[model samples]
Target: MEGKPEDDGGDLTRRGFLGGTGAALVVAGVPTLGGVGVEEEGVSTQLLEAVPQTAIRVTVNGTEHRVEVEDRWTLNEFLRDHIGLTGSKIGCNRGECGACTVLLDGEPVYSCSTLAVWADGREIVTVEGLERGGDVSPLQQAFMDHNAAQCGFCTPGQLMTATALLDRIPQPTTGEVREAMVGNLCRCSNYNAIVEAVLAAAATSGSGGAQ
Candidate 1:
C-alpha cells in the first residue's frame, strides 16, 4: 500500500501548470528589449546619479567670484568662461606650454592644471590684473619697449611668471631670470628681447644690474 501509485494525472498537470506560471511571472518582472532582457537602464541611472555638482568661491585680482561647477572643472575654465578673463590662453591644456599660467597667492601656477575648487579662499592674479590706473605694469611696459612680444599669445603667462619671479627676487640676474622663466615658452624665439625686458625692468626698479 505504501509503494502503490495514486495515478493522479490531474495533480501532475497542476504542478506543471504552476511551474510554467511562475516562469512567466519571472519573465514579466524582468525588463526586456526586443524580447531580450536588458540591463542597461539601471547602469545608466547609476552613472548619472554618481555625478555631483560642486560650488566654490574664488577671489581673482581682488574680486570675489562665486561659481557652480562640476568636480572636473578646471581653474582655466572658471577664469575664461565664468569670470570672462581670457588672458590665460588654453595652449596644450595639460600644463606643458605654460600659456595658461596665473598667480595664486603671489606664486606662479598653471591655471589649466589647477582645479577651480582648489582655488577657493585663495588670491588669484591674472595678466588682466597687472594693470595699474589704466597703465600696464613696469614689466609689461618693458616688454612692449623691448618688443619682447611677437604673436603675443604667450605674453600674458610670461608676464605673470616674470611678475612672480621679480616679486620674489626683486633683482634677478640674466641667468636667474632665464632659469625662472623656464616654464614659459615663446614660439617667436624672442628670448633675447624677453631677457632684455626683464633686465630693463630690474634696472628701473633699482634692483641692481644683471649678473
Candidate 2:
C-alpha cells in the first residue's frame, strides 16, 4: 500500500489549502511552482529565495543617481519608496488604472508595471518633475483653473499622461485629448474638466515642463 508524504518538521505543512487550489489562484503572485509545491500545496513565502538586487544608474527629473534596486521592485516602488517621490499614486497597483503614470524617456509609462532595473540609464519624469524654477507648469495650472482634480488621487497620473500627449500633439483638439487620455482613469468621473485642462495647457505650451 502507498503511503502519503510526511512533513519534515518545517513551518510549511503538506496540507495547505489543497481543497481550494483553483479558487486560491485568484490571488496575485500566489503561483504554484512546477517543483516548489505551491502547486502541490507546499513551500511557505518565508522559505522563498532571497529577492535579487541590482545597481542601476538612472536620471530622475534632471538629477542622476546610482542606486541599488531589487529586480522585482517596480518603477513606482523605486520612485516612491527609495527616492521619496510620491507624486505618482498607486491607485490599482496594476497597469490598468494609470494612476502610477510617469514619463519614461519622453513617453508615458505605467510605473507600477515597469521594473526599476528596466529604467537603467533612462530618463524618468514624475509628477513632481512638472515644476520648473519653483513654478507649476502650464498644464498643472490649467488643471487647477479647470478644477480637474477632485480627490486628487489620479491627478498626478493624469498630468503625466497629458504631458506626453501635448508633447506629441502641441495643439490637440478636444477629441484628440479624450483619445490620448483614455488610459488614465479618474474615479471622480471628472473627464470633462480633465480634457479641458489638457486642451487649455496645449494652447499655452508645447511641453508640460518635462525634460
Those runs of model 1 whose alpha carbons end farther than 4 Å from true positions after fitting are: 1-51, 206-211
lDDT of 1: 0.79
* List of clashing residue pairs for candidate 2: none
Cα displacement (angstroms), candidate 2, residue 76, comes to: 0.4
The worst-scoring run of ten residues by lDDT in candidate 2 lies at 30-39
Judge candidate 1 at residue 112 and give its lDDT: 93
Best-performing candidate as measured by lDDT? 2
What tens-digit string does per-residue lDDT give for candidate 1 at 22-71? 66874774443124323475463321233344777878887887877657
Residue-by-residue lDDT tens digits, candidate 2, 53-158: 7899999999998998889999998998678787899999979989999999999999999899999999999999999999999999999999999999999999
C-alpha positional error of residue 191 in candidate 2 after TM-score superposition, expressed in Å = 0.3
Question: What TM-score would you give candidate 2 relative to the actual structure?
Answer: 0.77
TM accuracy, model 1: 0.74
- Candidate 2's C-alpha runs over 4 A off are 1-48
